[model samples]
Structures are given as C-alpha cells and as structure tokens.
Target chain A: MQATESVIYNRAGQRVVSPEYLLFEAPRTKHFMTGSEAVKEAVRRASVDASVSYPITPQSEAAHLIGELWVEGYVGVYFRGESEFGVMSEIAGCAMAGARTITTTSGPGTLRAFENFPMWAGTRIPVQLVLMARGVNSPLSIQPDNLEVGFLLDTGCMIWYAENAQDLFDMILAGFVVAEQPDVHVPVITVVDGFFVSHTREAIMLPPDDIALPPYNPYRAPMPVIDAEVPPGRFLRDPFVMKSNYISYATHASWQWEVRSAIERSRPYAKRYLKGLIEEFGDPSAELVFVACGTAAAQAKEAVRLLEDEGIKARVVKLKTIRPFPVEELKGAVKNAKYIFVPEFNVVGWLEREVRRYLYGHSDAEVIGSPRVAGGMTMPAEVIVQEVLKLTGKEVKHVL
Target chain B: MMRKRVNIRMPALGGQGAVTAAHIIATAADYEGYYAVSNPFFGAEKRMAPAESYARIGLEPIFDRGEVVYPDVIMVFHPQVITMGKSYTMPFYSGIKRKGLIIINTEEDLLTDEDKERLESLDVKVLNFPATKLAIDIAGTELSTNMAMIGALFGAIGCVGLDAIEEGIKSRFLKKFVASGGTASLDSALERKFKKKLELIEKNLNTAKGAYDLAQRWAGEQGLEPFLPPPPKKVTV
Candidate 1:
C-alpha cells in the first residue's frame, strides 16, 4: 500500500472496511504481547488523524509507541503536549477541527485534565481518551489502583472498563466506532487498570494490519464540522458567552441532558460492537454471583472456577460498559442470583455502590462488597475465595 | 497424577531479569498449547530493589493476575532474595505448595536449619546451583542468568521441550519485545556484549542448555514427577 497526501493505506494494500467487518469478519492471528503493545497494534489500524501525549507511568510507553506509529506513517499527526491539561485541550482542538483524535492519561493526570472531559461531551466532540487507571496522589503511587475512575463517573464521557489485554485491544477499536456514531457523538473513556493490563503479557488475537476500520467521516457528525471545508454552527461558533436569561438557563439544562442522552443512545451500538455490554461465564444456574469489571472481573472469573471445584455454584457478570450502565442486562443476569459479591481494586467500592443503587428495588439479592484491595494491592483469587466462604458461612478450605 | 495448573513465583532484585524469565516461561508454555499469563509485581521497580514476577500455566484458561501469592514453584534468581531477606514475602518460601519445588541461584545453600525443617514439613524440595556462574561459564556474561533460571524451571517441570524454549527465546530477542524499561535496557546491554544479534541468541541458548542438563539430571535423580500434564497437542504455528 502506498501513502497519498491525505489518505494512508496499510502495507498489505487492503481497503479500509466497515467497523463490523473489521472487528468480526476479518480473520485474526494470535500474538503474545502486553497491553501497551496491543494499544499500538490497535491504533495502527484505527486511521487516527492526530494524537497528543504527555508522560506518565504505565501509559508513557504506549504513548511513545503511538508516536512511533506516527513516524511509521500509520498516524497522520502526532506531538508531545506540555502537560495533561494542555494535552487534553490540544486533542479537543484536533477533534473540533474535524480530525479523529485520541490521548491517554493516568491517575493524577486524569484529575489534572479533568475539566476538558465535560467540555468534550458538551461540545459533542467524539475524541477517545484511553484512561489507564492508577492511584490518586497525596500519597503518590504509580501502581494500578482504579480509584480515579470513580471521579470520572459523572464526566459524561462514555466509560468502558477492559478486563485484560485482549479486551483492551478490542474495546479501543470498538470505542471509536461507538463514540463517533451520529446519535452518540460524545467522548469515550476506555478505562483499564494500569500496570495489571498495561504491563502484563498474554495471548491476544488481532486482525490483520492490512485491514482497518474506515476513516472518520466528519460530514456524518450531528454537528457541523469546524474545518475550512464546511461552515461551523452559528450557536457553536462562540459557546462560552452567557446571557442570564430563561432561554440560556433552559438551553444549558436541556443540553446537559442531551449530552447524557447521547451516552444512553450508544447502548445498541456498544452492545453490538462489544458483543455485549456484560459478559457472563460459569454455571448459568448458579445462585452465587460476582459483579465486577476490569481486573476485578478477571479475578472473579478465577474465583468462580475455584468455587466450582469445591462443588459450590457461582458465576461472574463482567460489566463492559460503566456509563449507559447496562441496567436491564444486569437485572436479567442477576435474576437468579441470591448472593452477589462485588470484588474491586479500590477502597471506595464504587462498583458495589453502582450495583446496589441499580438493584435497589429490582432484586432481593444481598449485595456484598468483599476483598477490596487498595493502594495497588493484589487481590488474588484465593482472597476472593476466602471472602466467598466467609460470607456464605461455608468452611474456608486450604485450597492453595 | 498430573497437576492441571502450575503457578510459579519468581522473587529477585530489580534488573535481575525475573520479569523477562516470567515472560519467556509463559510464552514457552503458550507455544506448547497451554493457557498462560505472566506479570511483574506492581511497584516502583529500581535496580537492586526487591522485584518479583509471576507466571501461571494451565490446561484451562488462566484469568488470575498480579503477584502470585501461592505458587507451585518458586525460582529465586538471586542469593540476596534469601540471605538479605530482599523479598516481598517474609519467609521467601511463604506459600509453596506441598511437594512444590524451589530453585535457588546460589553456589551455597542459604536456607537455615529451621527454614529447611519448615520446607521439609511441607515436602518442598530446594535445588541450589550457581546459575550466574553457569551463565558466565557458558554465555560468558552474567546477563544471561535469566536464561539459566528459565532452563532450570522447564527442566524440573519436565513439560515444555527445548525446541519450544528456543522458539520462546527467539520470539523475545528477534522481535520487538517490551517487558519494562529496565528489561529493555538490559537487553541492549546484552546485544552490545555479544556484538551480533544471532551470536547473542546463541550464547543465551548455550547458557540455558548448560543449566537445563544439570537440572534435568538432578530432577531425574530425585524422582521429581512431571509438574504438569502433557500440554494439549502442540499447535505448530
């Protein structure tokens, strides 16, 4: 494949296909690598227009790899930003100028760039932020602690938690497809636990590099493109100016609702592209269940297996999307469950609260948050087993 | 009876290539058609600091991640991990399973009498050898110490063949591999020492082969059974 002035073709000379064909129909070969490498491979086929990066642990290597892609001609524009705040604004500018934009950040960086997220949603720019979650500062830790994700829950960006390296690869590609939809033109935040997913090596199947998802079409956006090819929206030309009138107040209120509604509108697309908003595994008829996401869900899967070995029935309801929370699908999955355990890597039990709030009157199952490992502690499968046995009044076996 | 899953914990000082060893072991297991996962300890890793990594190999899909709290095998890549108590766990052999194996890279036995008695109670066997010495003797550099450790791991397990190990080593060195910042630097240092890429791989392979022969002979004499069942039919890729 040759590179034209504007369009870039992969080395195999294959034309870009639809997202569905690229994700499902295309044959994939297995590769053993880390999630950072997975990010590079995914962006290699994403047809990304521009990327701005800042330095942070567990995410800097991936950001550097993307810069390498830029040098390799897979990405159109790339540069290092002054800071996370500046980087977020720079990517927002890229998106506003009708360029497909992506960036990454970790714990403190996420908070430092916090203001741009809501603005990204309000302006309806479909930029994707791959948030490698880590511990917030004040004690200063660079390990994988997802307490930062709790702060982004209300940021209006569509949130999706990836379980492992394979999930990270697929979700990133699928995230762009879902976020760029006309009805769902909101920013997407693909969250993965730092270090655990970013540094761990595992096997993942990837589609051929020759094939890629079709390029971003700014014309399909619900809002007008801000580039020279098209005139910008009249009201959007200058959005910061405010008039203290009832119309302004009402417009502000309704637009916030609409931004959230756009996230809700992404359900069908996310469900279809991600295969499901929630993945189920283990005994289908089990009464004991685990509701988790990210590495917690991976640990829960292993716990399910260990629980099964002891003749106890259990299952895992792994949540793929946090925003536009799959309430109905979750309700359907936990209908038969009597004891629901939520395993998490943070002290806040944010997922447990979400499960409880959503299931307040829908189900009678007792929601219990167990084995919360904070400050980047490892929540091994054995810890989950002990939690399960202790909660269920079963004798804890020395299985290890 | 053959075990279905084997979790190996490696504790060593930073820059000792424990993380690389973990990656190669899992990659070799994957080549032999087993599900495997490997990861380093989540911390600020520095040179000479207590660094650890874990690998899980099983017939079924392995989902557990992070540090291996419980291990069927423990490979101590440095004498300091035992003598200086430069380890995350207090006893260094804290969670070894019954009849598990511990391979220590030291010329002398570092276990105290009480420690040996505790290990004996758990029926765990300790294999001590100067792995760094073997690396210097065969590879002419101590940087290949990880290669020797990997060899001993597969030697005692008696499952992954030498050809698969070779494939794992080739994929790691010949391809654009990224384990961490320190490991990448160490890799370049090895390349500079060998002067050629193929020669570097050849030296590392020779170091591993030397350690493999010694460990295999010792394992056979000790009647150590296969740590894992024969991996599902090898998929030639």
Candidate 2:
C-alpha cells in the first residue's frame, strides 16, 4: 500500500481499539503553563543531558527552564552562552559526544544559528533546538511570527511548528524521534509561537513516564584510528598527492547524496508515528480538513470541532512533523476533502511560496493560505471556522 | 432531541475581564454537573476597540471551541460595541437560536426605540440592566459589570443556580484576586456586585405566572396572538 493509505488503514485500526487499551496515554493534567514550560517537559522527557543557549525574548524562558532543570540535577550538563554562534558550537560538540543537546533562541538568534545548522545537518549530528519565532523586522513591533522558519526551509534541518501548548509538548517529544532516526541523522529545530506558545497558558495532556523509549541509532562516522607503532611510519607526501587525498571530490558527492537520501528515508517513519499519535487522540475523517502547525493547529482543531458541532463535516490534520514535510501523507489525508485551509503565522514570502508551488503540481485540492498579520495575538477559533466555512461554501451564522 | 446550546459572549477587549466572565459561566455549568467549555475569542484589537470572549454550555461536552455563532444569550460588556454592530453584532445575531436572549449592560432607558424594536422584531428576549451603575454602587467603580451580567444570566437561565455561580466565582476568581491584590480586584468586584441582578431575575421568574395570566387575558380580549418574525438573514462568511 502507499504510505498514505497505510496511515489511513492504521488510523482506522486504532479507532477500532478503545481508549482503555492504548499504552502510554498522555494524562489529562490541568495546569496553567506557558508554552515554554510544556517544551521544557519534552526536553526532560527526552532525557536531554546538556543545553547551550543565549537569552532572547520568548525563547529565553525555555533556556531558563533548562537551567533550572540542570541545577536540580535533571540533566548532566548545561551551558549559558554569550551568543548564538557559541551555543550551536557547544550543542554540536555535546551531541558529537553522545549527549542529547539543545539550544533555544528567537528572531536574530535564529538567523545567527541558521548559518551553522546546515553544517550540523551535513555532518549528521542530532542536536535539537527550539526556535521561538518572532516577526522579522516588520512594521509592527515584536510578537509571535514564523518568518525565520520559512527562511531555513532548504537548510536540511528537520523543522516543525507548535500550534499550541499541547502541540509544543508533542512536537518536542516527536522531535527526538525524528532527529535520532538512523536513516535521518539530521538536526531538528522545533519552531513555536513566540508570544502565543511561549507566553500563553493552557491545559495540556502529558504522556505517561513508563512508555518505552523509541529505539535510538547513533550516527556513525569513520574516525581515524592511529596505533603508535603503525602511525610512526609515514611516506613523505608530494603536494599533489596530499591535495587529492585530503580533498576527495568523490567523498563530498557521496556524503551530499547521503544527506538528501536520509531526509527522504525519514518519511515513512514520520507517517507511522503521526498516525499512531492521532489514533490515540481522535478520529480524523471529515469533509473539510484544516492543515496547520504549531499553536495555530490547536486553534484550528477547536475551530473544526465547533464547525462539526454546527452540523458541518470538518476535521483538522495537524502537521506535527513538518521537517520531513510529510507531504505525501498529508496529500493522502486531505485528498478526498472539498477544501483545505493552511493558516500560517508568517507571511508566505518564500517558504509557503515554495510549499504552494510543490503542492500545486501534486494535488488538485484548492489550498487557501490565511496569513495572519498581527503579532502572535490569538486567532479566535471563530475566525478560523468562518474562513473555513466560507472556503467550503457552507452556511455560517453571524453573531450580532 | 438535541438540547439547545446556549452561547454567552463577553465583549472582546483587553482588561475587560471578558475571559474571566466566560470562565465563570463554564465553571458554573460544570458545577451544575453539565458538560461545558469556555473559550476566549481573541483578535488584534486596540484597547478600546471591541473584542469578544465566549462560553459554550450544554449537557454534552462542547466539541466546538470557536466563537459562539448562534448564542442563546449574547452579553455585551461595552456599550460602544453595539455601534460596531456592523462588524461584531451582525455575525452574532445571524447565529442566534430561536427565542434567544440579548443582554446589554446598560440602563433600559438608554436604548433607542429603533434598537429595541429591531431586536424585539427578531423574537429576541432583550434585557437591559444597568450593570455598570450597579457595579459603581457596590464597588465604587464601574468595573464589575461582567460579574453582574453573569449574575443576571444565572437568574435568567436557572439551569445553573446562584450558589453554584458564587462558588465558581469564589473558587475561580476571588481567591486568586485576593492573592494578586489589585490585579484581581476588578474581577472580584464584578462577581460580587452582579448578585443584585441575579436577585432581580429570581423575582421576575417568581412573578412570571401572574404576568403570563394577565398577558393571556389581554391577548384573548384583543383577539390577537403574537406574530413570529422572519428568519434572520443568512451569513455566508
């Protein structure tokens, strides 16, 4: 079966199972927690031993929380850095040493780190970082924004956005799985709403502790081994021989293909994991499907349920795994639907422009991109439903 | 039969305690052992511009977390919001269930004849309580209208009782307000001052039978029955 069909069948099978039979369900824990606190829980759950960070608005709390964890002995190492460059360097080093590492930043910090993220991807490091998003020098003052994530789309880093507090938790949990996948040994950056997810408080359901950890496969690199006796003898090298051997053009080409193939190989694993997670939560078959990530997905889900209650057949397909771009699976899930609404926290400058380009050639569905202009002020669920209803040509009631 | 879903909308604005009002209503319904969910409607609005928060209360767990379209009860905290009727109120009225109620936190005399007639024509039960005045009288400020409005709603619906609302408010707001000092005082004051409106609603319900008898007799003598208004205009967006 096609990967998408496999996902649908798996979801159907999961629906056949009762909630009582699911293992490792997230507990319905009610607490007033900011998005950063929830992300902190994911880092804790992932057993991150070290975090390197520089303080920035919105994302600063995430680093602070990690610091608290380190002080409390939750992790083995923590580093407060002076700049984004330093943080990423430390993260790469720690991850190379087999420690799960993370870094947190927003806006300018995110831009600074982007310079090195591709290098980490090229080197097959599994460093995880949180990119709390903010507006990119827009006319409006600082607030929640997603411009940076869009800019880094082709950087080979696995990227996803959190729609709300719950999504933040789920993405953090899922990020580890994506980052450490054997075939996709690439870095991951989980983007969350700067003001919405980073500052706001909402109830969340936390997965239980006893859930078995997903299998981990460490990245394999060929390290040069030297023995004292064998290494002592060396032939005097000619300049041409040294250059050809040191800069093997073939090695670079092979490694580049491996990086590309690794990302492609991660698709099936992502689909399986997302399908399992959704089945454990709610059913996803409906007439209209709303696609969003990060905190926007939370609002979209609520909007879908509201529309459904009003006798409109609607549901939400939250893209928890955005990095591998779960395109095939998403296309399959939304293929039969009449309309798809993609609400984005950022302007569709280049990133969404690319997604639209890709989606256009693949699917015939009419995809509407609703770009939110204001800073991360919460988009009322009502507004989202109304937009979806309009797209689907459904009758909507007005509140006067 | 599907039970009627009542939506209680708090006008959207910052520092207006709109979210607090929505929470109190939801908690009150839950206290009454009814399945309820309260969601705050947020948008980018200036400090004085209208914004809305909403509560969805029913016997079933609320599946919709969006804005209440056809609210059985629509509550407006700011009087100016009524003028923004073209934008906010239009959407609200389009979804109002039959025999729904519209509650405005202003004195009855403040409504123009046109405003009252238009709402009454829709078969909407309109109640204009001087909640701001009541709040000022109780707390020496005009900030407690949301609470007073909630009190009036409890009296109006009776699905959730005043005691349950009080407990909901005390447990949800007062304790927090006290600890937060000035931060929570406005919310506490609103809840406390709205008790009078609840009392008025109870009194009205108690005397409803006599009023119903008198109305019936007058209708019989006049040889007329009330006419139903045309259905509300459908909104596409």
Candidate 3:
C-alpha cells in the first residue's frame, strides 16, 4: 500500500495556507499515531523544500518516513548523507541555498553534528533540526535521555521541547514560521525525548492533507540567499580564519552575540506561533510547582493528577522553549509557588539550573532538582510523588 | 464501579507482535472514542528477547508517558516470559495493581505457587489460554498469535466492541500503518503466506473472533465484570 493515500498531489500544486490558518483555522481529524509518524504528517503539510537524512536509533524511522515523503513528492529534494556531520552540513547548504530545509538526529548523532548548529545560526540559515534527544555514549545506550540538549543549549539555535507527539506536530509546523522570520531567522532545533516520543504511539489531531503551510521565501531573509541572485555577502563568501587581525576577532564575537540576539528576537514570534513559550497545568495557585520540559513535563503532569488524588496542591510549568528560556512566562507561572521542583531525564538537571538561574531575584522559592533519571532510565510519575512527599517531610504513600 | 482508566502491559519475546498488539488495542480504544496511548520498551529488540509494550485507555486524556510501571492488566504473550525469566520486570507481574487481570497465552499454568499466592493477595485474576494454538488453528499461522492476545484482552475487559477491534485491524493492515521496521516485514511475510491481503485480514479477524469467544466464556465462568466502563456512547443530535 502507498504510505499515504492522502498525499495525492505534488507539493507544487498544493494550496499554501498561512501557518496560523494551518495550525488553528483548518478543520482537524483525530488520528492515532506515534511521534515518528507525526513527524511525517507534519513534514507532509510543511511545504518543505529539502530534507537530509542519516540513520540513528529512535530517530531512524522518522528519518525514513521523511525520505518516503520525498519519494512521494511532498518534500522537493531529499537524500541520505554519509553521517550526522555530513547531514547537518548538507541541510545548512540547502538552507543557505534558499531551501526550507529539515533533518533529524539523535544522541551521538546530535553531538556528531554539533559544529554545524552554531555555523547555521552564524550563517542565519533557517533550517529545522528535529533533535530526538537520546543518551550520549560512554557506555553506549539507545534509549531516551536528553543530555544532548544540554550540549546544544549554547549552540545559538532556537531550541523547542515538545512534551509529546501532538506538541511535536504543532511545533515543527510553527517552528519553520517562527525561525524563518526576517528578524529571527536562524536554525530551530525542536527536541523531543527520543523513544518516549519517537517510538510511542498516541492520538493527535491533524489538519487535512490537501492544504499546506506557505512555502519559504528566501528573498525575505535578512542575509543574502546563496542562489547566485545577489552576490553573496563578503563575510559569507570568505572564511574568517584567513584574517588574523583584531577586527576578525571582534567580528566573530559580535556575530556570535547577534546570533544570540536573533534567538531572543524569536521569543515574540515563538510566543505568538506556539501559543505560549510555556504551558501551565494543575491548580493555578499551587504552592508546589514543577518546572520541566519534554518527557519530564509529561511525568510531572501525571504527578499533578496523583498529587491531586492525595489532596496536594501541585502544578507544572512546562517549558516549551528552552534556548530562549521562557523567563517571564515561567515567573508568572510560578509566582505563587513556595517550592519549585525541576524533574529532568538528564543527570545534569540543565532545566533546573536554568530555572534556578532565571528565578534568582524574581522568586524566593527554593529550587530543588529532584527525581533525576539518567542513562536511559524511565521516570515514572510515582517517583516524582515520592520525592515530593519525602521533601515535604510527609509519609510516602506511593512507590514504583 | 468500573475503572475510568486501564493500563495494560504486555511482556513478550520480540517478533511475538506484542508491540503491534499494543498499537491495535490503543487504536481500537481510540475508535471507541476513548483516549488511548501505547509504547514499546526502549530497547534493542531481537527475536525471543524480552520485548515489553504498554497501552493505556481512559475516559480522560492520558498524560502519563514512558513505561507503565504500574499496570492494571498484564498480558504474557509467551510462557518464556514467565518460565525462562524472560521479562524486563521480575516475576512477569511486577507493579501490577490490586484486583487487576493477567492473561497468559499458554494452555498450561506457568506461575509458581509463590506467584499465585501474591496474585491472590492482590485480588488479581489469571487467565491461562492457548492463544498461539488458537492462532494456528483459526488463522492457519502462528504469526496471528498477537491477534488472539488482542482478542482475549478486549474479551475479558468487555469494554471495546468487536467492531472497533475490526476497525483497528483494518487500519493496521489494510491502510498504510507505521509501527516498526520488523513489524512491517512480518506483515509482508504474512501476506505472502495468505496469498491476498484481504484473505490475510479475514483469517486474522477470525482468529481474534475465536479467541474473543473463548475469553468471554472464561470471564463469564469467573463472574468477572467488565474492567473498564464501556466507551462513552456516541452522541447523535
């Protein structure tokens, strides 16, 4: 059977709808799917111009599905690259050449492709990297652990964390729009906890396949597109390593600062397109709060329900945007909290550090990095509840 | 009172189709208008290796993700998952809730006396049936074993109707579905054996029907109530 009977027409013939129209206004039908499948559905409607692929566990199926999209003519140009480094570079070239480019990688693959991220941002190429965060190798692991995201925190790419398949679908479609804005044009790395999302099947609402997001307009880029239209900018044309002058050092430093600024500028567009940079769940005035992202947020939301059952007031401030940290939205979300818990899949508790760093002067709540799971371990909500109980000096009522 | 939410865990050997079963059960539940979620164990699966998967169906949206540490039901698709200690969780019934159900696919009882005592204290019921035998007998292939397991699950639960199960099966096989690389290849192998795709689907459906009937009878004999409330009735204006 054809992979998608719904993909009836070439992308060229598809009617291009606005991102808002595609996301909010279009009629939707609920379908059961895994996170990887959700990626294919998103790419099908994304009006993507190019995609590069490399095989990595948890992300391989999603990458394969995108290649299927290419074969079916939804994606204009698609090919498999030699490695994650090669794949990342290929996508950067596609974006620099004025193609709306996308790609997928995980764990070691993400780390392998690390150099291109900052370069893509420095080049101001609006490529979308769907990073399926998995465990990095020391002793190798293929299971879901998001430690790699910590490594990419300073990569100058606008980072988004999707809690599950549905969030992934919406973020990818909106990711392109927000990342491609003239003022905010930079690489967008949408991270979902590998396997937890990449392999898990759940229900998500999808817009009809006949419509698609408006195609990328390379002419609108703040930087010149390297399509031989206008002569490529001098800085883009030459490698900065050739010049050993003080101006080159200043140029590199200022350009890195501008890349960071571009990420900050994405906040308004991201807040508007993604609906909010953070999502609040559970009691609005909850004193016990959790600041989390990706699957940790999922576990925390479940913990909220279990806490409710125990007559505990708890809430979750799920951070959707990680690089352009939702500082203001988070402050508002946790204003009433006396104790804030940050649950994370990585051992570093990078999210906890971010929450602590941002809320230093804003809130007096004691920030605790509790119930951290690493090395591909699964964090059940019960673990979170037990942690809360122990921290509160209450009797532990649940364990798993 | 019926459960508003039910979490089911299936620990089976790889290639046994527990992952596919989990997907179809969740799909069937979704078709019945209930919120459902499913996932496989995060591991590199190989044939005969312990491969676990989970499915949660509920009246409310299921926010819980990753492994189902505490399951309302446990379905053991192969006796090796019990006899050979081939399971991710110990005793093949770890973290099962009180008054839950376990359906095993062997005709012979595989649980140790200690296992029986623990389950009894928890008020859990164990249903031992030859699901693979049913698959071989009805579908003329052992590959339909997961189909029998799916039937037995819904049959004992008595929540999702057969129509929804058929729809789930149809969507899985007839329509373009993505689960895993191994699953897709196994599907092609089954189709080649059956000669036609429609015939393959029909035989698989019959296998599920046969097992469902057997499970229904067993549940009736044990005076088991439906574990979950029936899917909320369709609202028609």
Candidate 4:
C-alpha cells in the first residue's frame, strides 16, 4: 500500500509541501536515582496537579518520595489516604476535574486500583500510575515479582515495563506524554521491578526537566459546563441523544485503533528521542542486547559490562516506554543481534510471553526468558550475566 | 571523594528496640551534620528469629541501598546472638570491613578464649561492653539497651556529642514511649543513663587527664589508629 501525503496549509492560505520529519535533540544527563525517585521527578517535570497514594511495600517509597515532593511545594496536590482504593478514586476525581493526576502502588494495590482502571479508561481520563510488579498468593513474599502485570494485561491501559533504573526514569517521563496525548487518552501504567528497581540505586542519567518534557496538556473531562442564563437541557436522559452519543462509543473504539496507529506512527519520534539520549551519552550497542525494563534492565547493563570485559559482546536495550510498546523500534534495534534476553522481575507468564509474541514474526533472534518468581529475592547481576553467557553458548563461570 | 561510610547492624529480636537504636545512631549522625540514612531489613521473622536493622553514616552521598553487605561496624544488642556463633554471626561478620569494629552488648567475660582468638585472628576490634548491665544499673531495666548503645556510640564516634544524642532520643523515642504509657519512667531512665555515662567520662578525664587518652594509648601500642579499628579478614571455611 502506498503511503498518501497529508496536505498542510500555511498561514497565507497556500498549500505547503513537506515530507514528515521525526527528530528531537538529545536530553541532558544527571546523576543516578531509584525508579521511585525517577517517577517522582517525572511527575514534577510533567507538572502533575494531583497525586493520591497508599502505602505498599516496594512501591511505598515512590508514594512517600512523591509526597515529600508535594510537601516541598515542587508538585501539585498530594493526598495520603488509608487505602489504594481511595488513592485510585482520588486520581479518578482529580482527572475528571481537569487535573493531571497520578497514583502509585504495587501488586495487590494495582489489582485493587484496577477497579478504577476500566472507569478511568471509559471516561477517557489521562491518569498515570506507577505499578511496581510484586508477587501475590504464592507463599506470600514481599520481594520483586511481576504477578501484578499479568493481572493487568487485559486492562485497556497502556503498560510500560522498565528494565532498570535509567529506563525507569525515561519511561516515566515518556508515559506522561503518552498518557496525556489527546489521540491516546488511556491511562498508562509504568511497571518497574519491586525491591530490585524500586529500592535499589544505580547510576541513572536523568534528563533535565527543561530539556526532555513537552508542554503540559491538562485533562478535559467529558461533562459539559452549564451556564445560569442558558435553558437547562437533559444531559443523559434522551434516547436520541444517547443514540448520537453511541457515535461517541464508535469514536472511543476508533480512538483505541488510533492509539495503536499513533503508537506505530510515533516510532520514528521514539527512535529520535532514544537517539538523542545516545548522542548525549553513547549508543549502548553490544553483540547480545538484553531487552528488559525497570531494575532488571539495570542489572542487565551491569551484566553486559561484565560480559564485555570477559570478551563477550553484550548490550542492554532497556525499555523506558513499555506502554505504546516500542515494538517496532525494539525489533529494528535487535533484529541483527544473536540473542535477546528478557528478564522480568515479575513472573514469566505475561509480558515475556507478549514480548516473545511481538518478536516472533519480526525477527529471527532467539529471545531467552529469565523469569524470576515474585517475592523470591533480588536476582544478582552475576546471575544474569552467567545466564546470557549460557544462552550464547559461552562457559558460565558464576552461579547464584 | 572517598568518605568513611559506616553501616551499624543491631542484633535483637522484635520489640527489643534494636531498630530504634540504629535510627538513633543515624539521627545522631545527622544531628552532627553528617549525611546519614537508616532502613530496616525486616522480614517474616517474628519476635525470635533474629531481626536486623541497618544504619549507614557517611560524609558523602550513599549509592548502594541494598542490605549492608560490608559494614564498618556491627553492633550487637543481644549477647546470645554471638553465642549462636556461625549461624547468627556469620551473616554480620561476613560484611565487616577490614578495619571494622564489633561491639557486643554483654559482660566482658561472655567471650570464650577460642572466640577471642578467632576474632583477633580476623583482626576485628571486639569491644565487649556490659550494655545490659549498664542499662539495669542506670535505668533499672535492661530494656534501656538502646539508650546504652547510643551512649557507647557517642563514646566511640565522639563526633556526635551527648547533647545531640539526647536530642535524638527525645525527638524519636520520647513521644513513642509516652504514647505507650511509660512516659515519665522512660524519661527518668534515659536521664539517669545519660548522667551515669557523663559521670564515667568525667571520672575517666580526672584519672586519665585527657578524654580518650587510655583508648588512644592502647590503640597506639597496638599500632592502631584511635577510634579507627583494623579491618577484619574475610572469613573462610
């Protein structure tokens, strides 16, 4: 199919012909911080108006740190509530009131927060949530796991998985834009590895606030404003009006298709942003590129470094934007690589499976899965490196 | 720039205020204008399965936020934790820096000759202070071990003075103790403990002429720097 040109008219009322250009300058780099700190910084950079959060392990620090930012008057409204339900409800109310709202939580909290997900999606509220993957049900441990993301897969919200601290920082920043985009008003949940990325600290190049984020777009609720002088009209009671609104239902479904298309359309832009990051630092191209998100990605980078020192070509493509999954860019980046290691802090059942599916028809690269059970324990870098070597038919020297 | 970073891990079961002791040390350091961060490594372990809390103090920013795999100081609030030997002590001992200090809250005679030999071989400066005894003598209850440890930390670091320690204790523990219905008694106990430690230091000065003179003299004789102990060797089976 031939790509048709979308015409553009200049201010002089004359047609102007120009090919599409997707380009962005490199963002500045700063010192490292945790995923939670990154999320809080993103919220601050995005000028998020309101945030509500409840305490949950692994994810609690994000909420606490954001609350600290709120107390310091760096962010907007902050509410510390009794439960995750209350936090989600507050986010929904804030979003409906035309505020850029956010809330963070973990596995069970994400599950409880999921009740608000459908409503928020239905109302087309642009709320951002940082969901830390943790275990639920099995043996009951409070360590890093991805069971929560599995439960959230069916939800209409876009999911972004961060492989390490740096990706966590970038993904949170990107999520603000993706969630607030008018064409894609679905809430975005950026999941990071609990305990591993949530609590662990590593060197992260945080983009400067002024350098990275675009202009803020405040949420607009569907409810129309009423005036005293104007005669009151029935809002939801008329069948004809409901039928006309059913057109909105079609619009909503089409909006979902548009989101998918925009995601594909945004590929070149995403690539430009990533290239900008690389230009500021350097390209992280290794022989075997480990694709991961959150803290696991951080470990993968360290592992790659260790492997490279041991005469192995290993690099890590840490996914900073999970939702609006940068599938095309990832495929393009790793298509030439021999092996793509995807390590998730959560269970292997969902995201890894999805990644494998995404890569199935696109690349011939062998996507190896290293699924760490939820709440098990932090998977050391040495273990990840050894796994990569094993997958590449290299002798493993270390075992954890 | 490299700065001295010390992680103090307390060995006490739940409800023993071991975590509070670590917090007090961290808060005391902060009060002294040193950067400090404290976090508890709490798990499913209940009252007796050996709970540990970590406190990190540094002049520079701290990066590694995991469990204190290598600690400059390991402060044990319970003597039984040491008696348990390899099982309870190995995890703590494994992380001790080469020139680390290990302060055990017990009577001096609690360590066996073999235990002393083992620690000496590892080059660990083991100080067996009767913190519980000191607590009972001053506070009339062994539960004031956290306060006693704070006093000991003040004695060891010397950077944090009694005033800062008192303020830290007041800010962190006073309200909590009062809320738990032991307000007056806990305050009096804390004051008495502080007074006793002050009296000991005053007496030490009168006898020895300079503060920490005896400690310095002993450490100098052993070719060790004052307040800076020798690093412990990595334990091998």
Which is the leading candidate under DockQ?
1
Considering TM-score, which of the candidate structures 2 and 4 is the better prediction for this target?
4
Label model 1 with its docking quality class: medium
| Regions of model 1 farther than 4 Å from truth | A1-14, A232-238, A244-246, B176-195, B234-236
Deviation in Å, model 2, residue B31 alpha carbon: 6.8
Deviating ranges (above 4 Å) for candidate 3: A1-11, A232-239, A244-246, A398-400, B177-195, B233-237
TM-score of each: 0.95, 0.62, 0.95, 0.63
Residues B1-237, candidate 3: write the lDDT tens digits: 457889999999999999999999999989887888999999999999999999999988888878888899999999999889999898789899988999999989888899999999999999998999999999999999999999999889888889989988987886564335553466578667446778889998999999889899999999999877766753211
The Cα local distance difference test for each model comes to 0.89, 0.61, 0.89, 0.60
Instruction: Tell me how far the alpha carbon of residue A127 in candidate 2 is from the true structure, in angstroms, after superposition.
Output: 3.6
List-wise, what DockQ does each model earn?
A: 0.59, 0.06, 0.56, 0.06
Interface RMSD of each: 2.5, 9.9, 3.5, 10.9
| Rank ordering of all candidates by lDDT, starting from the highest | 3, 1, 2, 4
Q: Write the per-residue lDDT of candidate 1 for residues A1-400, one digit (tens) a residue.
A: 2234555454324467778877888888888888888999988888888999999987987898998888777888899999999999999999988888888899999999999989899889999999999998879998889998998998889999999999999999999999999999999999999988888999898998877878888888877878867764354632444665556766778888999999999999999999999999899999999999999999999888888877899999999999989999999999999999999989899999999999999998989998799998988888899889999999877466
Q: Say which prediction, candidate 1 or candidate 4, comes out ahead on TM-score.
A: 1
The local lDDT score (0 to 100) that residue A86 gets in candidate 2 is 80
lDDT of 4 by residue, B105-190 (tens): 77755666775676677677876667667666665566676667666655654456555565555545333112124434566887
Candidate 4 Cα misplacement greater than 4 A, ranges? A1-46, A61-82, A161-174, A197-255, A259-286, A308-311, A386-393, A396-400, B1-50, B53-237
What C-alpha lDDT does candidate 1 achieve relative to the native structure? 0.89
Q: Model 2: which docking level applies? A: incorrect
lDDT of 2 by residue, A1-400 (tens): 1223322212112121112212135344444345787877766555565788798776887788877667655556887877888888778777766666778888877777667887777767777788888866656445666778888777778776666666677766666666677667678778876766675444456654323232232423221112222332552211122555556666667767777777777666555544432211124566566677765666676676567667776777766666667666566776676666777766653434644665776766777776354454446567787777676677887442
What docking grade does candidate 4 earn?
incorrect
